[model samples]
Target: MEHDQELNNNLRKVKEKFMLDLVDKLNRINRDGLEYGSSALNVCYMTSIVDKQILQCEEFLKDISRGYFIEDYEEDPTGYTNGSIEIQCLNATKTYTLKFTESYCGDMAQCYPSFKLSERHGVGEYEWNYFEDDYEEYEANFNKKYSAIYKDIEQKKKERRIQDIKIQMEMLSQELTALES
Candidate 1:
């Protein structure tokens, strides 16, 4: 009985560790993609790199969900397609949706992802904005925000490049080890 318990505990720990690593990798991939730039080539490269990680994360979630029972499921709300995905939490009785727009026109024109949370009673939305007009007053503010985001993207690219190098080194090390053995 004790041995069985130990084995189960070890397995649980391994699962947790794997999940954490996968989550970290997903985050890195996302950051790297964003940092790559908005050009078509960069976008395609980023998509390719991140797509596999996204699938792995989905598979990992599915594997873990097998241990538990899901109580409720719902079809997605109407008119929420085209780069939008809705997530409904059965346990919490809450629904969340993420929508990305290449160009969103509201008070201003901007390009970014929009996140929304909804419950039975109320809804909340978050979005980023950019200057739509050439007004001098808004120019300074807009420039500042744009510069900040640009700097952040550059920094992320640097971090992603370093991480890629590390991953390559680790793969090489494993191959060398196998060859030696």
Candidate 2:
């Protein structure tokens, strides 16, 4: 509708070859969201899974990713109820949260709330510096209304969607070759 730089790039060649192809096989909801399935864009908006290690290799390349554990906090029960790590996937504009769990520390601490990045979709990295002032409020919300986001689980779910796109594109490529022949 508006001036779309992407759709306009190589205007005639791309448009003629694969308008609907890019639109549908990429699992786009509409013509407007054609970019959603692009590899560049996928690196942007993953549903979950955030860690600093994503900065390494950084290819958006590795298919299999290993998970890590991040020790978020070890605090006393004195006035401390709960906590959350708000993360923005690198290149992604939206934010998702990592909720910690209070495990027994054998009296060393009352709450040893830790974050574990489990094996999953291996989506892109994240930047968790957006809402720093929410430590107090986040604990309140996590205690009252919010549910935890399992980075591994959610990221794997998103990974499935991405896999489907890849499979379908390969089918389409074969179809195009056959048609040309």
Highest lDDT scorer: 1
Regions of model 1 farther than 4 Å from truth:
1-145
> Candidate 1's residue-wise lDDT over 1-181, tens digit each?
9986775565565455433433333344445545664211122221221222232233223343334222221223563422333444444434444232233566545333333333354344444343434233444543353454345545776776788899999999999999999
* Predicted structure 1, TM vs. truth: 0.25
Per-residue accuracy of model 2 over 62-166 as CA lDDT, tens digit each? 221121122222222553323333333344333333333333444655333333322233333233332334434544443333122223333554676788999
Query: What overall lDDT goes with each candidate model?
Result: 0.41, 0.34
Cand. 2 Cα-lDDT: 0.34
- The number of the candidate with the highest TM-score is 1
Mark the 10 consecutive residues where model 2 has the least summed lDDT: 40-49
